[model samples]
Target: MEYGEAQQEDESTTKAAYNPTEEDIIEYARFLGILEEEDAKLLFIAREGIAAPLPPEWKPCQDEDGEIFYFNFSTGESSWDHPSDSYFRTRLVR
Candidate 1:
């Protein structure tokens, strides 16, 4: 198996499931600096369908619709929404 596939299999076996709390989502919003504290709550709710506590191998990606999103490694979910314009700005910087 390729290194990436091997690593994924190892992680799938070893990692515990994660469910992100409102507070956790808010904290991530603050870290991204995309929304104000008050707005973070709404963002959390709106994105809850796609949200998971960020996993160790979380990475940013763009969807087919051209919307930026996050991929959670642990849960194998691709529901994380783009938090803010700042997130895209930061990614561009990188």
Candidate 2:
């Protein structure tokens, strides 16, 4: 998959760091499917931005067509365009 460009701006909203232990791996494997060695879960979790493995299931991305596609969240890569900082404003009320 192709990745978009990264933009920078003032930000404070942070994503909490999470570490996955052995049990976490097992749970994640249960969701992503177990590998021959059951070691690929780490890769999958990392690919999914693995902010603490929680059941290995989450709302990974909201697509361009307004579809909620579920998958592993990759903190490394963003699947869509999101304001990386507070410079941009989000309008809630119409």
Candidate 3:
């Protein structure tokens, strides 16, 4: 196929359930100043599958004390950190 046709095909593709590709994630990471922050590595880890993604049922929240926490609605469990160490290594730098 020609380059123009390939580009058209890509543009015409529907993304009902869009998940960013590694290139997309890296571009975002770069825009976010990846080299200047530790938390930026988390994006790479998550996108590259080096770490597991957070469980869909688990939600992240902050307490009144301004600390991070994870709540698992499926199990009625809550914790100061993610249940999976491999999912998120540290608090998000937001």
lDDT of each: 0.45, 0.35, 0.49
> Any idea what lDDT model 3 has?
0.49
* Residue 58 lDDT (model 2): 26
TM-score of each: 0.32, 0.25, 0.36
Q: Specify the highest-lDDT model's number.
A: 3
> lDDT by residue for model 3 over 1-94, one digit each (tens)?
1121111112113233357776766654554345425565457544543234456776555565555466666776776544665433343345
The segments of candidate 3 whose C-alpha lies over 4 angstroms from its true place after superposition are 1-52, 86-94
Q: Which wins on TM-score, candidate 1 or candidate 3?
A: 3
Q: Residue 27 deviation, candidate 1, in Å?
A: 0.3
lDDT of 2 at 5: 26
- Scored against the true structure, residue 84 in model 1 reaches a CA lDDT of 41
In the range 1-94, model 1's lDDT, one tens digit per residue, is: 1123222223232225446666666666555553654553446433442243334665555545554455555666554453343433343221
Task: State the RMSD for candidate 2.
Answer: 16.0
Q: How many backbone clashes does candidate 1 have?
A: 0
Error of 1 at 40 (Å): 4.6
Candidate 2 structure lDDT? 0.35
- RMSD per candidate (Å) reads 11.6, 16.0, 15.8
